[model samples]
Structures are given as structure tokens and as C-alpha cells.
Target: MGATQKMTIFKLCILAGAALVGTMSVAAQAMTPAQTMLGDAPSVPKNIVIMIGDGMGPAYTSAYRYYKDNPDTQEIEQTVFDRLLVGTSSTYPARVSGYVTDSAAAATALATGVKSYNGAISVDINKQTIPTIMEKAKALGLATGVAVTSQINHATPAAFLSHNESRSNYDALAKSYLTTDTDVMLGGGKKYFPVSLIEKFQAKGYQYLSDFNQLDSIKQGKVIGLFANVQLPWAIDDNDKNKLSKMTAKALELLSQHDKGFVLLIEGSLIDWAGHNNDIVTAMGEMEEFANAIEVVEQYIRNNDNTLMLVTADHNTGGLSIGANGEYSWNTSIIRGVQASPDFIANDALIHDDWLARVSLNLGFEPNEDEASQLARARMQGKEVMTTSIKHLIDSRSNTGWTTGGHTGVDVQVFATGPAASLFAGYQDNTDIANKLISLLPKAKSKSQSNK
Candidate 1:
């Protein structure tokens, strides 16, 4: 779609909420008639792949696009996915949940088609159980997979396979994985899976793989792999390069092996993490990496033709925004830094330990022994040297404002292609996501398999 055309549709969706002057400049660009018409509902795809960009909102997407399109100014364009769509509300009862929503509640709406209070997972406000798209797809004999950049048991992924009163019930939720016939379970949260439950998975004949190398060895059946104790690294980290996309590709490869089509939920969970930390560089880099995974899926869909790819976020984090007027050059540098950073950096602790030294080395401004000693003493006292530096760096970068380091109630953007893409058009409740997916799946012969 042309820039103008894309902005028009974006404005339409934005208008569904309160009008903000901030969105007007973007909306002035008209979308192509063909691109706008592409929103028309298409045939149901045989395979449904939902890519959840947890905590990414329109603001984040716009920032990424701005840097990507303006590559002449020294900013490296780093994006794998091209098309875009505006996302909708995950609010419950429409007006009851207010405009803001949390990940757990937003994910529940996306997964089960019902919005609940904040912190609830896969259940409605009344604490009632709801059928998820994955469960429905399974009953139709479709293969299923859930891949995330956070703990596999995190709220977004867990909403697809497990239900609980609180999203924090990692131990209880970890065990529920055993009952679901989900074909591929990838990402972090190794600690939540008690030793006994890990053994139980083994007993159930699941091929438990701990590393990416082991993924190649699995030829059949279900596979559960946890790459970290909690959340995985940001895509900008060199240490985690290719692991997230690798897991996504592997899951697609294995799940496609089944005679029946598959449904995969791939989450770029750390874009939200970076947002919470107000790390623009990290957030943009992770978004680019996640887009790479989308490209992989897009290629698969192109060949398969029967697969639908849906890209969206559960909620917005940090309410990220880009200034209309800024030194385009600095934005370019930041974008280049993001593109240069490999998929996944070293863990935060390792970065913390060596970051100062590395920055000093690269900038040719190392502190003297006395200054270093003072910094070490400050660190020993639990003070942050890097935090202070980052704040200064951010203040110098842009006039962008942030209300909180937490998730916002803003509507996220959703982009879809292939079959049933029209179902995503217009302003719809988050629960509509579940209903739309159910409509796309083949109807089951038994009532238990059908969504009421």
C-alpha cells in the first residue's frame, strides 16, 4: 500500500476512538484503493498463524516505519514485514473495562474472544472458562504451536492453552501444558516447570529439547523446549541472535509435517519488555527481529497459499511516540544501532557487568582507575551507572513522552493476510478475535469441539 493509502485506513480506525491531533499528520496520506479494498473478507485459510507482538502499539509501529523508510539519512532500514493494519480494543463489556487494558486481559480477549479484568488469563470477568482458538483448532484435527520470546508460561502464550484466576500461577499453568496436545511449545520459563513436571513430560513421551541444536533432531510428535528461566533476551542482543526466529521456523517446519494444517502463535514478547524499560533502541531492534520471523511465515504462506498470517499486539507499552520534528540524523543513528544489534543480546546482567567498559572502550573515553573504583563502589551499593547514562541518552534523543513504564489501554494494530483477513477489519472487541478464528476453523462433528 502507498504511504497515503495506509495512513487513511489507520486514521479511520483511530477515529473510531477519540480524535487525536497527533494522528492527523499520518492520516493525511491516502491509502491505495486496492490496499483499502484488501480489507475485504477472503476465503477461510486452511492454516491460521497468529503473530502476537505483545505490548506493541501503533506508536511503536510508526517509529519503526519512520526510520525504515528514511534510509537516505544514514539510518539503516530494518524490517522484514511490509503490510500493516490498525489493531482494536481488548476491552471487556465494551465500556466496562475502560480504554486501557493489561496483557493478561488483552490476551484473554485475543485468545478466548472474551475480555476479563486485568490479570485474568483465558477466563471472563465472571471467572468462567472459555475455549481458545488453539483448543478449537485441535478438535478440528489441526496441529498447533505456541512460540514466544518470553516464558512459555507467560500471560500471552498461556492464554492460548491454559486458564487460571491469576496469570502469576506459573506452577499450576506449567502443568497444564501436559494435557494440551499442542505440537510445539518453545521459549523460556524453565524454572516454572518443576522437575517432576519435566519428568512427567518425558513420561508422556514428549521429546524435551533444551537447545536449538536439539530442535533439528526432533522428527515427530510433540516437542517442548524452554530456552531460559524467565524471559528470553531482546533481539538486539548478540547472544540471542536467531534463537527466536529459529524456534519459529522449526515449529513451522515440524507442525507442517502433520497431514492437517497447523495454527501457530509466535510472540515477540520482549518488545514490550524493552518498552517498559523505555529502551527505544532495544524495542526497535526487537520489532525488526520479530518482523524477520513474520517474513519466514510469509514465505511459507506464499508457498502454501492455504495459510493465514495475522500480526498484532495484546497491548501498548510505554505509549511510545515519535516527535514530528527532530534531527532525522540522530533517528537514523539509533535505527542503525538497532539494525546492527544481533537478534538477542547477552543477558541483562552480563550487559550490566561489561557495558560501561565496552562503552568506554568504543568511545575512547575510559575512566581512570580512580573513577572506575568509585563506579565499582557505587555498583556495590546497588546504584546504577548505566541507568543514569541511559536516561541522559534518551533525553538527548527525542522529545517523545512516556506516561508510565507499564502497559496502556490504547488499541494495538493488527495486520493480516491470506484467508479471512476481512474479519479483522473495523473496530471490534478483542473477543471478536476468538470468534473470527473459530469461524475460520473447520466445524467439528462433536459439540465439545465447537465454540458455543
Candidate 2:
């Protein structure tokens, strides 16, 4: 009947990036699990499913909702987040040194309940390893797994699974997986792990799946899926079927076998990538993919009464702003008509004289002679320049505005449903997210205290 009784449920967190102002802020703390507010509350959660939308921001979701709601406009036809919206969380890292936080720090804060330095992964600015929620879940005998659209060793997921002073330690980060007996792992980034180490994993009884078809036949036990050599393609070009829904479905099916339940982190990693390009088509496509994954997770929660699902973003990306050129109203019809992302167009733009013409074909608007000239000039300059030009061209065509291709300091929304989901309401810092989740788990002495 009391609040503590509700804390015993499992948690599924899907980090969708939409804007909300953060109401509270806090300094970084050691990974000390908060003592139970209600002493009678259970410490163990049956399952925790967290899916982080890497660079999703408020404008991203706003545009998605508007476009979806206005058949002539939205990126997603519908989303579970519409009904489950909770609150927002501040994304700044541990210190006043900077306001905007990078993926590593934001994710580390979410994973360890600590505000780490900009590039730190599950480690504080002091360079000490901070124990993560996933680690705690695993230590308590709960199954742990991660399914992401990024390389398994990418910063966001790495913050949950590895600890390093530098997030760029791809080799070190990837190897850390061998040391941790995580139940299931899936994503791109085969290049990060060596052939020898991957072989060692198989020898250790880890089932390695290299494709979705291979993933389809998975029956049980620990799994490591490496679907690409690096980051997977945008959701629009996900012709190979490495869909987020499939990844989440497979992860849920496998992780649910644990008697103690599971803690699985599924990341819509490409959302950030799309944001970096300011590719609205790609961003919306990725949102749809993430939304589909949420739909699947929602079904899981429906069948399983004890599951708590949380969705939030690490940081907003691309400084995306809808209704560009001071328009009183924006048109969703443009977004609705696009068949391919600018990233795809940029790639095809190369090796063709009429690439802008091709872009018009895919985007439903043709560039003027001056715009086409700029694209040709950019193509002559290099890939980076050409890509920028392509995105700018899309911006010109669709009137989608962006301030930056990098991450922003804006607050992001956190949506939740299930028992104890109300604990996540209000303006909290990113660390509060991990801290709240930790409170639901059995109180353990702080890792810092352990050394003492």
C-alpha cells in the first residue's frame, strides 16, 4: 500500500531526446546507493531496460510529434512516449567548468550516479572507476545485456559497461567486455574487438551473432552480436534488417529468462549521428525506429506487470530548431515526402555530376543553379565539405534550421510508466536518474567506502 511496495518492480528505461527544462542540479557523488526512503522497499528490481537516444533533443521530438500527428507532417505515425511523458533532467556534467556535457559524461552520470568529466566513461574527473548500475545489477545476480545502434564500445553504452579515463580507448573498452560476464550484448563495432578476443569470447561460451539472421536463430544463453564493422546505417537505409525493434525484441526474449530478471541498455545510437548531420530525414527515421522499439518494450511491460520503463536522452544534438525562416507555421509535407536522408544523398552525390538533381528526386525539391554550384564546389573540396553542403541544401529545401552539429546543453524529457515510475517525475540532474534507480536496489556500501 506504501511507496516502498512499488519499488520492487523491474525498470525499462528508453532515453528519447525531446526538450524539457531541468528543475534540479547536483554536484557529482561517489557511487553510493541511497538508503531506502521506505526501509521496507525491496532492493532488487526484476528487470531494467534503458534505451538511450544518443543526441535526441526537444526540437527533435517536437518535430516528430507534430509531423506524426499531422499526417501531412510527423516523422513517427505514433509513439508510446506521447502517453508516458514524465519530466526533464539537466544534462550538464559534474562541474561548473562547463554547462554542456558530452555523451560519455552524460551517459556515465546516468550509469553510475556520478558526474564524470567530459570524456570519462563511468569514471569521475578524479580518474577513478565508478561502479555502474549495470555492474550493481550483475553483482546482485541479475542478468545484464546491452543492445544499441552504436558500436557496443561507443561512449554511451561504454559508460554502463566499462570504466576508462578516456572514452576513445576503443580497444581497451572493447576488451573490458571479456572481463565482465555480461549475459547478452549486441551492436556494431567489430573493428573495436580483435579476432583473437572475439574467438576467446566464443571459447568462453558466448554465442557470437554477426547478422540479424544469425540473431534470429538465437535460443538462449550469453550472446554477443556484432552486426557492422563500425556504426550501423541510418534507420532509413536499414535495408539489412538490423532494426532497433528486432534488437530490443531479441534482447528482451533472451534476458527475461533470468530468474532475477535483467538489466538491458538498448541505445538508439544513430539518432545522435543523424543529429550531427542535421539530417531531419535521418533523425525522424531514427525516431521512428526508436519508437518502434518502445512499442515492442511496451508490449513486454503489458504482459509483465512488474516492469518499469524509463525513456530519456543523454543530450540534445544538432541544435535543431523547427519552423525556420521565422515562418508562422512549418510544413510537415516536406518531411513526409523525403525518401532518403542527406547522408545517403551526400554519399551518392559523389561520382555523379547531377547529384543535386538526384537529391531533388529523393527530397522532393530541386536546388537552384547556385545551390548546385555550391554542392559541386564542396564535392571538389572533400567528403566532409560535401556532406555539409548536402545537409545545408536539405535545410534550404525543407527550411529546417540547426545551430550546431554538436551536442547541446538543453534539458531532455524522461518518460516513465509502471510501479515507482512516479519517483522519476520533476526536474532532476542526469545523476538523479541513476541515483533513483540505485535506490530501488539493495543498499550496498559506496564503492569508495569499500576501498577504505
Candidate 3:
């Protein structure tokens, strides 16, 4: 068949899949009362927290279950995911952008309930601004903010707070955040906000913080904290492993003070970075950190019945698999022994005289003669090659498999809790998540009503 014919066939397959999904959704809704959609019910939430585990696919969660499992126990222990998983979400962007989605398009759909071309942030396919859930919450007199491990202006958070034709317009996104009326914004990307711009934010009474330690000192009011130059340090390498969790706690504390409640977007953003690098150690560490954040939110929801929390991913990255190369088992023990990220290990070894010692020490296991030779050969090639080699070796040891460094056109898992969470159950598209969230938000006041 010609290329055009193949493309037509692929699109047909996608349409057929979508039809099946719709049918399954109907079947799910008919299954039980707990799965019923509560449209405009009295149980509307006063607060909403949407947590995005960027690039986290089903496989990642499944892998995490085993990674956190206790070997001494006969049955595998269930994590927070097993307890609250509601359904799966298809993450395809607009038809024009094809099946697989980038973070920007996925975030746009999640933020605005509108699909857009990849790289567009909160803008429709026609390059016009679409209202985001955060904007809507602000309009309704509720507080709104975003907390992520990535730079606050990165694709996911940027989509929630700003409108831009391109996600790469980092400077523009940062500037836009100045007037977003967002109550709290925490993450990295101090470089994007120059002294003058930060002063403007200060002039507007936003308490700007550059140090992570300062997060706790401010007990009230609008706050913006930028903790790193770009993204924060990896979970495995950081002094505070619960950094995302801490941010989530602070966001909840600050946003909840608003009388009208709040809308907070918390993203485990570095999970995508680890996936893109095919670094299993870092991926697992990021997963653990993300889970910590989830626990924080889950507890908050248990305490606050008026809050709704939804957790989903933008798309699956690295096509992660549990076993590889004809292996029948994955060795979580090996992964647990990894003390640092592959890139960190590789860089440390390059400057050391005893490269094997450094490598073995970081890996927490001595390499065999053959493995040592492989490491030496990679070290000879240079830092970048050594990093890849280290990851490959770790993957081989742990039997972790990755099909690609880029994202795949796969359905990601959705988890929800609190009032109206059941409405998120069953098969749905990414935009459906945004649409449902938008539906639950309180109506914005008219200008004349505000004047009155």
C-alpha cells in the first residue's frame, strides 16, 4: 500500500478504537451506582486538586507496585494506585496532531478541555486562547495555583496558568504568570524570571522565594517559590526526597485558606525526564516521590470532604516494560540497590581514578570482570556514552525494558477520589477529564453582580 493508504488505515483504526472506548464507558456506567455520573449534584466540591504524573503509563504504575513490594510477604502489597484507580484515559491530541501527544497538547486538553496541536499551550488548534480550569476557578473567586517538580513555566504548569502559541516561549509564559492572579506557584525556573520581572511580582504583593527552606516561613498570603535554576534535583540524588510532597503540603495549606476554596495542579514533572533518558533508577525514584505527593493529597481529601483530587498522566513515555530480552522475571532488588541516577554515577566515575570502584559503590554491587570491561570501554568513549552504557547495564541487570525514548500512543491510567470522583470512572479521553473538572467548578460572577 502507498503511504497515504497506510495513513488512512491508521486513522480508521484510531476511530474504531475510540468507538470501542465509548461502548466500554457505557458498559461501565451501567455496572453500579458507584460508577454513575453525578451531573450537577449537590455534592459539588469546593476544592479541586489535579495531579499529573507526566509520562506515567500503566506499565510505570505496575512496575512501581512490584518495586515497592515486600519480598517476605506472600502477596504483593497494593500501593495507593491499586486503592484508587478509577479508569484509563486515551491521550491522543487533536486529529491534526496525530495519535501520540507531547506534554503541551496533553496539558492543553487537561487544562482547557480543548484539544490543540502539539507544542501549543492552552491555545486551540486555531491559535486562540481557551479558558483553563485555573482561570475559571480564579473567576469564581476561588484560589488557584500549580506545584510541580519541573520549572513552573514548563509545558504542564504553563498550560494551566498561561496562553501561548508555543510551549518553548518560556519567557513569555513566566511573564504571563505575573498577572494570572494565582495564589501559589512553586517549582524551578528562576532563570526565566529576571530581577525586574520578579520585582513586578513583589510589587503586586506576591511573596517571592528563591530558597526551598523559605517555603515554610510564609504561613499565609500569595507566594511564589523557585527552588532551582531549571528543574529540581532528581529524587534519588536530592537531600530532601519528599520535595514534591512538601510542595503539595504547602500548596494545600496555602490554597485552602481561601474562603471560596482552591484549585491546585501538582505535577511529578521529572518522571517524564527520567523516562526520556530511559533511566530506570531515576524513574523508580521519581515514582516514589510522586507517590509521596499522592499520599499527601489522599490524606487531605480524607480530611476535607469538599475537595476532589484527580491523578492522571499526559502520556506514556519510554514504553516501559517489566521484563526484557526473553527474561521471565524483573529483579526489583537490583533496582533498589541503585543509590543514584545513571547520569550522576557516570559523571562521578569520569573524574575518579578508580572508575570501577566508584561505579560499584554507586550501584551497590560489584561488577563482574565482563561488566567491568564494558564499563571501562564506555568510560573510554566519554561521559555521555558512559551514562547510556550505565543505564543499559542497569536495565540488563534489572530486566527493565524500554521500547523508545519518546512517548507512545497509549492510554494512561486515571485515579480519582473525593466528592464526584466516581464521575471520572471508566474509559475517557484526556479532554474529558478537563471537561468534567470544568463542569464541577463554581460559576463565575457576572461583572454587574460583582459591582453590586
- lDDT tens digits by residue: candidate 3, 72-129: 9999999988877889999999999999999999999999999999999999999999
Clashes per prediction?
16, 20, 0
Model 2 residue runs over 4 Å out of place are 1-45, 72-78, 240-242, 353-357, 442-452
Cα lDDT for residue 408, candidate 3: 98
Error of 2 at 362 (Å): 1.5
Assess the local accuracy of residue 411 in candidate 1 as a C-alpha lDDT between 0 and 100.
Answer: 66
List the candidate 1 regions with Cα displacement exceeding 4 Å: 1-42, 73-82, 86-97, 324-330, 338-357, 360-385, 398-400, 446-452
In lDDT terms, how accurate is model 1? 0.72
Q: At residue 280, what lDDT does model 2 achieve?
A: 83
Model 2 weakest 10-residue run by lDDT: 27-36
Which prediction has the highest TM-score against the true structure?
3
Over all chains combined, what TM-score does candidate 3 have? 0.91
Runs off by more than 4 Å, candidate 3: 1-42, 445-452
TM-score of each: 0.79, 0.85, 0.91
Please provide, for model 2 over 1-452, each residue's C-alpha lDDT reduced to its tens digit, 9 standing for 90 to 100: 65665543322111111111222222111111111112222334457778788888878778888667745443545456666666899999978439899999999999999997899999888899999989898887788899898899999989999899998999999999997888888889999878898999999999988876798899899999998899877878767533789989999999998887778898999989888878887888888889888778877876765566678999999999886888766667777677777667777878677767787787777777898789789988877788778777766666888898798899999876554666677689889999998777645668898899
lDDT of every model, 2 decimals: 0.72, 0.80, 0.92
Candidate 1: deviation at residue 352, Å?
Answer: 11
Candidate number that wins on lDDT, 1 or 2:
2
